[model samples]
Target: MNTASPTRKPSRIQKRNRKLILDAALEVFSTHGYRGATLDQIATCAGLSKPNILYYFTGKEEIHITLLNGLMDTWLAPMREIDPEGDPLEEILRYVHRKLEMSREFPRESRLFANEIIQGAPRIGPHLEAGLKPLVDETSTLFEGWMAAGKLAQMDARHLIFSIWATTQHYADFAAQVRVLMGEADVEGGARAHLDMMFRRLLRP
Candidate 1:
């Protein structure tokens, strides 16, 4: 007999609590990976009761999914910024620089995503198919166009993109190994210079 009413927007407190939970969850997920992370750990990190954390997110899986879903835009923005009309080498190098900067600044987010993918992305597979695949396809097409015009070296565009991702993300994903190998040198600056030089040489026509 009664009709369902519309849902109200979250209050300021609710928004703040949600952010706190997400921040805590990112730290936990990045450190422990999805399988190792626990709700109690997240609740303690967020300074919320288990029930309160559950009030914001249904469970650990939901929290992990929410954190990852939110990260997709930020993660893919460099790819999205690739301009077809701009100078091809410059555009690609700029995208590389932005990605390296993201690695330095948001390593936690980077590791969280890397962990999800390493585990076969069971939670995020659908989102990747729906959101990530199209972007990669579009970028690959642009790379192919540049190759056809002799603006870039002839190569598989998708593999080129994959190479860029692997090279740039290695700094974040294997940061500990890099530190151990590099000793006390300037890691970030050195990586930036190395990546810029490598891509410029690789992409030059």
Candidate 2:
């Protein structure tokens, strides 16, 4: 009955090779998006043969979907942190920071995800309806409760969530435009102040 393989640590070489593949896939996918990227390009980026790359992942869609699925947990975590018991302003502000940090740390993942949605989210439809919709609904309820208690500025709770998303994700989704207008130095120190001011103004009670 005890026939299951024991959990084993990845060998150092395996870990390095895996990173190589994921890094290469990120670069290719981010540049060309899922529809445009090719397995050959991804393999070249990984310094491996296409067959070798396929060993790590079965095919292009697999790698693309895998990356998106992996990114979702981290993406959803901040929203889950919305504490019903926490001060409303602070709870939302903390959520804002978590989002901003994700933009800064995982801009490529952000872009890839955006590309998927920009294409009508063909791969993530059920996930949006099932996973994200519920979280948004729950969070909206919390926001409504805050408003009823006079804890926040009276506004549409769902729209408030949308606004927070739009503001925080702007840095990643529109990064090239932002850099073009705001310049490269902006991400270094400017984003933090810009976001803080934006949220503070929006959330002022």
Candidate 3:
């Protein structure tokens, strides 16, 4: 929580310690959730003392918020990459594939986000309203424009986005169940192929 002074650059040790705390906190919070996680657990996971964690972050909530804020940028990157000028169907399919890739590669992060959202995003609610809402509104308008132009099939743009999130994130948020059902099969590959076909058909003009 803004531990380092603004005027002075953080030392190499400070940088290393901060990274250790964040990486360890990600594991703890992802496994236990914000309510369940503790600074002691983060300290143990980081192999650092409790005091060390406190030095970097004010407390558990601060650490959790920092992680969520960083994750928000990562989570929104694919949506931000949506090009308004690109082919409507191709752009949407590309976004779907990118989202699936994130779920596969960052399962812990995905689950961490899912947990925050499911818990009503008490801490992150303001951030969501500020950051996420605008992006969604903009994307909805983009999708609506495409539909109006007959470039994409007519549908509820917001619900379409929500469906994309739900479908893609299921692979990560429910990874344990998916693994059990998939049983060593190529989960990401299958999901990508299936989602591509599904969205293509849905959005085809």
After superposition, the stretches of candidate 1 with alpha carbons farther than 4 Å from their true spots are 1-6
Off by over 4 Å in 3: 1-4
Q: Per TM-score, what order, best first?
A: 3, 1, 2
lDDT of 3: 0.92
Q: What range of 10 consecutive residues in model 1 has the weakest lDDT sum? A: 1-10
With a 3 Å backbone cut-off (N, CA, C), the pairs that clash in candidate 3 are: none
Residue-level lDDT tens digits of model 3 in 11-114: 79988998999999899888889889888888999999998788888788888889999989999999999999999999999999999999989988999999
Off by over 4 Å in 2: 1-16, 184-188
Per-residue lDDT tens digits for candidate 1, residues 137-182, read 9999999999999999888989988888998889999999999999
In model 2, the number of clashes is 0
Alpha-carbon lDDT of model 2: 0.82
- The Cα local distance difference test for each model comes to 0.91, 0.82, 0.92
Candidate 1: deviation at residue 31, Å? 0.8
lDDT of 2 by residue, 1-205 (tens): 1113377666686667767888888888877888789888988988988987776666778778777777787789999988999999889988988888888898888888788888999987778898899999999999988988988888899988888788778888898888898764747467777777877777776
201: Cα error in model 1, Å: 1.0
